[model samples]
Target chain A: MPEQPVPRTGASGVIHDLGYRPYDGPRNGSGTIASALFLSGFRNAFGLGRSGKSKVLPFLLLALNLLPAVIIVGAMTLFNANELPLGYARYASATQILVSIFVAAQAPVLFSRDLRHGSIALYLARPLSSAAYAVARWAALLAATLVFLLVPIVALYVGAVLAELDFSEQTEEAAKAALLAVLLALMLTGISGLIASVSVRRGFAVVATIAVLLLGNGVVTAVQGISDEQGELRVGEVAGLFSPYSLYRGGTSALTDELFLTPPTGAVMTAAYFAVMVLVGIAGLAGIVLRYRRIAGR
Target chain B: MEQVIRTRGLTKDYGSVLALDDLSLDIGPGITGLVGANGAGKSTLIKVLLGLVPPSSGEATVLGLDVIRDAAAIRARVGYLPEHDCLPPDVSASDFVVHLGMMSGLPRVAARERAAEVLRHVGLAEERYRPMGGYSTGMKQRAKLAQALAHDPRLVLLDEPTNGLDPAARDDMLGLVQRVGQDFGFSVLVTSHLLGELERVSDNVVILDSGRLLRASQTRDFLDATGTLLVEVIGADAQTRMGHALAAAGVPVQARGGLLALDPAPELGLDVHDLIRDTAFDLGVGLVRIQADHRRIEDVFADA
Candidate 1:
C-alpha cells in the first residue's frame, strides 16, 4: 500500500454558488400526494424497496399461503376429481393463520416504519393532510393484504378451470371468494393498521397484530366453549365475531353453509355479525387516523 | 419590505412550563437570524409560524395566511428543518427527497426532477443514492435542506442547521444558507444559540430570552458604531503613553477594554481626530488602526 500524505485537520473548503431555481411548473394536489404515498406504502408492505432482511417474513408467509393451494390443485388433477373438496372461501379459512401472519409482518412495514423514524412529519408537512396520509396508508395495506389473501384463491379457481372441472360452480364460488377476500382485507387492514400505528416499533407491532388476530381468536373460542348456547344462535358462531380473522372465516363459512360442515348461522345473525365486525373494524381504523391526526404535521 | 412573518401576543405553554410568552413581533422579508439560549422559545416560534403548534393566545400570519385558520395553507408554502435528527436510516437520500417532493404536490416526474436539482444545489451530487444512515452530520443537514427546497417554498425555517457540525462544516453550512437566502431568493429564518454565528449571514436578528422577546431589529442596528472613536497606537507601551497624553489634553480619555477611547463631543473641535494623530506622532509611536469600536451583538445578551 502506498503511504498517504498527512492531511490538515482543519481547512477551508470552497463551494461554487450554483444557486437553485424556483419551481414554477404545474403541481398536483392532495389526491396525487396520497396516491404517491399509497404506491410507496404498497411497495413497502412487500419489502420491495427495503433491504433483503425486511423481505424475508413477508415473502415466506406469502409462499406458505400459496403452497397449500398448489398441493390441493395438483392432487385434484392427479386423482381425476371433478369437484374440489375444499371450496375457495374454506381454503382461505383453513389457511387463515398464514394470511394473518402476512398481515402481521407487512402492516408494520407500512405503518410503524414512518412513525418510528419520525418521517411522518415530512409526510404531513406536504400537501397531504394527516387524514389523507392515513387513508393512503390504509388503502395500501388493504390492497396488499387483499392480494396476499386472495391470490391463492384465484390460483385455486384458475387451476380448477384448467383441470376441466364444473365451470359454473367454480365461477360461482370464485365470486363468493372475491367478496370474502375483500371483507378479509378490510378486517385485517383496520386492525393491523391500528396496531402498527400505535406500536411504533416494527417488532412490537408485528407481535401485537399476531396476538390480536390469533390469540384473540383462541380466547374467544375458549369463551364460547365455556358458555352454553342460550337460544337458536350457536355459541361458537357468536364468539367468532369477537375476533377479526375468525369473524371473517365464520362469516364466510355461514354464507356457504351447504358446502361446509358447520351449521348455517341464520341470515339475520350473520348480518348482525357483519355489522358488529364492521363497526369494530371501523373503530380501530378511525383510531389509526386519529392517532396520526393528533401528531400529524407537528 | 413586505412583512414575511407577524405574531401578536403569541403565548404557548405546556402545562406549567411556558414556551413562548406574549411574543408579538413582525419580521420583514430577508434572512432573519433567530438567536436564543436553549429553552428560550426559538423552536417554539418556528413551530408556531409553521402552524405545527397552536399558540395559547394570539394571532400570527405567514405569507398572508393565518396560522390557525389556514394552517394547511401555511404548511403548503413554508419549509421547516426541525432541530432533531428526523431522517430515516433505511432509505437512500434520493428516494427520501423524492418521496417528500411528491408529498409536496409535485408529480412523480416533477418530484424526481426537483429532487435531483435541489440535491445538486445542496452539493449532494452522486452521494444522493447512498443511505442517509451513513451520512455525516453535515451531509444529513444538507439532505434536510434539500428536502426543504424540494417544494420550492416561499420561506424556510431552519432550526440550527449548524448543530453538531465541526468548524469547517459549520462554515460551509452557514455559507450555503447565506447564498441560498441571498442568491436563491428564498426568505430564511435560521436559528442558532451561538451569539455571532449569524452575523455575516443574516440581515435581521431577533433574540429571545427565557420565552420572551429580547431584541428584534436589523443586524447592523445593534452593531452600529457608537459616535466614539477607538485609537490604537503601535508599540509595547503605545496605549499607555497615548492614554496619558490624551488625558493631559483633557479629552476625557482612558484605557477602556484595550482601546484608547475619545469622546466625540462637538466642543472639543472639528479636528479632534487630527489632534490624536498629532499626539501619536509627537510621542514617537506609530498610529495603527483608528476606527469606531462598536458594541458587539453579544452585549445585548450579556445583561440578559
Candidate 2:
C-alpha cells in the first residue's frame, strides 16, 4: 500500500503545524563561567592576545625601557654591588614613559569596539551589567600589563639572589619590587580603562587618556613652579596625589634614589599621595562606566 | 496567549531625524514580521524593545516588564540577533555561544551543554568548533542564531536575519526562524522589507512607512482572496475573442496577456468557471486553467 500524500497549506499554515516549543531551564553559576569564557575566546579570536599586533608596539616600548634595567642588574651582579648602576633612575623613568604609551594605545580600542560594532546590544542582552563588563575588561588589561612588567622584574630578582648577595635584605627588596609593580599596573590600568569608557571612538579615547596622563602633571608642575620659590615638599606631594605618574615616582623613589626628585618628607605623605591617586583613578573609571550604561541602555 | 511585546508612543530621534516617530504597537506570541524598508524605523523599534536605546518619548514593555524601568529584567528573558555582522571572527561557534550563555547567568557545564544543543539545532554541529571567520555566510547566520537561542529566552528579536542571504539560504534561514518560534515555543519578532517572503512565515505583520505605522493585521487578512478570477485559454487570439464573448454573455472581462480577468459578483448569477468553459467551448478554444487571484499586501499600497 502507498502512503498518503501530505496536504498542502499556505506558508503560515506550515509554521502553525510545526508546534514549536520554547526553552525553559534554570540559570546558575555554570552560566556565568561559560559566558566569561566565551567572551575571552572572542577577544582572543580578534587578535587581542599578549603577542598580537595590537600589543606589539607597546610590548616593544616596554622591552626598550626594561633593557637598561636588565643591564644594570647584570652590572650590579658582576661587580657584586648592592647599589643600582649609573643612570638606573633614568631607566625607571623610561619604564613610566612606556607605561603611559601602553595605556594610551590600549584603552580606546578596548572600550570602543562594542559601541562601534553594535555588539553592546548583544552584551547587554545577557545577564551582565555595564559595571561587570567594565570590571572584566579592566581586569584583562591589568593582567596583561602585569605579565609585561613582572617578567623582567622576576628575571632581575632571581639574578640578584643567585649572585649570593646578602640573603636578609634581598628578600625584602624583592617584595618591595613586586608591590611596586602591582601599584604601577593598577594605576595605569584603572586610568586607561576609565578614559576609554568615555567615548565610542578609539582615536578620541586615546587622545583623551594621553592628555589626562601627560598634561595633567605639567599643569600641576607649572602651578607649583610659579607659586613656590622654595620647592616645597608639600607641593610635590600634593602634585603626586593628582597624577598616577607622580604617585608612582614618589613611591619608587622611596625604595631607590634612581626614582629622581627627592622622596616625600614622611611615610604618611607618601601613603596619602598613593591613596589619593588611586581614589581618583577609581572615580574616573566609575564615571565612565556610568556614562556607558546610559548610552547603551538606549 | 500573553502578548510578548507592547509599546505606546515609543519615539527615538537621531539628532534632528526621528528614527521612530510616535510608534505604538502590540505583538503577541508566535512569529510577527516587522516589515519596513531600510531607514523605515524597523530597527529602531527592535532596539527600543530590547532596551538598547532610550526612546525619545512614550513607553514599552516586553514580557510585561517595563522597557525603561526594568531593562535588566527585560534583557534577562529576551534574546536578540542584530542586523549587522558583529560576531568575533576568531572564535569558534560553540565557544562563543557557550560564553554568551554563561554571561546570561548559566552555569559552566550547563552553558556548554546548551551551546552544543543550539549549534546542532542550527545545523552547525560539524563546524561548531571551527573559527567563525572561516564559516560561510549561511554558517555565520546560523552561529548568530545559535547564540541567541543558547540562553533559552522567552522571545527573540531577529533583525534582518535574511539580509545578505541568497534565495536558498534565505529560505533556510526563514525555516529556522519559524522552527525557533514553533519548536522552541519562543515568541519571534523578525523583520524584513520583502513582503512576499514574510507572508510565507509570519502569523502577523506590522508595516511601517517613513517612521509611521502604516497597517497591522493577521497575515491572512492582508492576503485575503479577492472575488476575481484569472482565466487562461489556448489558441491564437484566445484572450481577445474570449474578452468579447464574456462581454456578450454579460460577464465583466478584461484581457490580460493570454488570460481574461473576470470580476465575479456573487449576486449576478455568474458562474465564472462555467462562463469561461462554455465561452471557450463555443469559441473552439482549449481551456487551459482557471484560478482565483489573491490580493497581496504590496498591492494594497501600489496606488500610493
Interface RMSD of each: 1.9, 4.0
DockQ of each: 0.45, 0.36
Alpha-carbon lDDT of model 2: 0.74
Per-candidate alpha-carbon RMSD to the true structure: 7.3, 6.5
What DockQ score does model 1 reach against the true complex? 0.45
Q: What is the model-wide C-alpha lDDT for candidate 1?
A: 0.83
Per-candidate total of colliding backbone pairs: 0, 21
Compute the lDDT of residue B295 as modeled in candidate 2: 83
lDDT of 2 by residue, A1-298 (tens): 9999998777763543323334456765423543474457334423453234655665576677578667868888778887444432233345665667766776665667667656666787665667667666666677666665666666666666777766666666666666767777787777777767667777887788778877876776565554355767567556556666666667777765444353455878867866765676577567766866786655
Writing each residue's lDDT as its tens digit, candidate 2 over B167-255 gives 99999999999988887888999999888888888899999988888888899998888878998888657777888888888777887
| Docking class for candidate 1 | acceptable
